[model samples]
Target: MKKVAIQGGGGSNHEIAAKAYFETDNIATVECNSFEELFSTLKEDHSIYGIIAIENTLVGSILQNYTLLKDSGMVIIGEYKLRIKHQLLALPGERLEDIREVHSHPMALAQCSDFFKQYPHIKMISRDDTALSGKWIRDNQLKGMAAIAPALAAEKYNLDIIAKDIETNKRNFTRFLIISHKEKIALEDILTQQPINKSSLVFALPHAEGSLSKVLSILAFYNINLSKIQSLPVVGSEWEYLFYIDLVFEDYKRYQQSLNAIRPLTRNLKSLGEYHVGKRSFDTVSNDNKPLSEQKTF
Candidate 1:
């Protein structure tokens, strides 16, 4: 059984994505109140695995998580993209109008901003985790308080959906990274199971003219599709930045060649992961983001 450390409580999106990714395995989740705690848990026990939200299509990147993951020295073995649908959950007998305050992760609250704008009377309070907020209201039996969290959270905590799909955009999605201690993964089996088509990388470059452009040109020559690139300033380094990038390609050998071709130009270039692009094959997560069956597999 895989022991996965997830951010937020049982029914949070992290947990949902975990189950969906590891669809056929008997895995256990260690609920963490924060991403920091999630990494700490993994560091303390290298046997445990982890899944974390890297970016949300609705709210953009979870910038802090990128830094944490970089510093954590954890390996990104896989990735999952979750379709997020936020719901306003409250006590069984409560109605939307009866709620005086809504609580959730800042991102969750922000995603549902338009819905809350319709209920200006309800105060929005930020919490560390989305599902945890609902769990707290249920545990405390708090009346007139609700949480904007996932639909699975309602089922987990026995909360009522005061409002369903409350997010401002119906087309919201969040991408999560599957991380593990290097020894915990059998890289051969993972890459061999499917075509290695995508990669995540982190690196820094010398502050030289056209240094970034040179790297991009090499990748282009090798036909590597630069799926995404994010830059964060290096602390105490004058005008230097760490680039976090995602690359996609049809040929694994060509991908490696691309990396090698540009490796000399980049400083401290680290390959975070090389895996399959998340798509229909991992669609076990239903419309409500619930597991289709109790079967264990990732």
Candidate 2:
């Protein structure tokens, strides 16, 4: 069986991907308690695949995961976008009025802040995983206690959904990336090709007026389109910023040339990674191919 190491407890978002990507009978799910555990497992297990939550519509970017991916050598093999549905789950026969404390992961609690505000008397406790929180509340049989987690988690833990779609924003989505220790193949290898809609790079610009303009001009010169630009505080530097950019390039060669041209204008330039422009989707396996259970490692 192919073992996939996923972030958070067994019933978290990562398991959703595992179910979508690999056959259940041939897949082994490894639960990681924290980001640290996830990274360590990735380093130790060469054959293991990982699904990490990169960003969410309601909660914003997962900055820590971004840093982890930036520093790690693992290649992003695929991505999956899961629609987040937050549920207020509690122990059996527990009513909303009976709930005094609600526990969940920080992000989950944040996303449901508005809902929680309605019950000002209820105390909010942040835990590691939303699903794990639900499990804890269930296992402990804590009356007047609930958790914010996905419906799958509620089903797995046999908790009742006291409230549904409790997020402040109705359009909640979380983008996850599937990473592998195996080397990434050239872009040409993927058959369902899409236009290179987004290009990401990290760079430090020279501290001078028009320096930023000059860097941007390189993209303009090549007719490269930029989608988003975010400036993050540069570590150990006071008032200086490291710029992260996302661009839409017509072609890879043009993107490369644009990057090459900007090299001299910036103090430092590095391509973090490149992915095709599109919403997340899963890979399809041929029916005739051997199941993961029958496959042998070299």
lDDT on C-alpha atoms for all candidate structures? 0.83, 0.74
Q: Estimate, for each residue in 74-157, the C-alpha lDDT of model 1 and write its tens digit.
A: 888878777788899999999988999999988888888888888889999999989989999999999999998899899999
Say which candidate scores most in TM-score: 1
Candidate 1 weakest lDDT stretch, 10 residues = 289-298
TM-score each candidate.
Answer: 0.89, 0.80
lDDT by residue (tens digit), candidate 2, 224-274: 877557777777885377777766765778888888899988766766556
Model 1 ranges off by over 4 Å: 24-26, 280-298
Residue 50 local lDDT, model 2: 80
Q: What lDDT, from 0 to 1, does candidate 2 have?
A: 0.74
lDDT of 1 at 253: 89
Q: Candidate 2: where is the Cα deviation over 4 Å?
A: 17-27, 182-197, 280-298
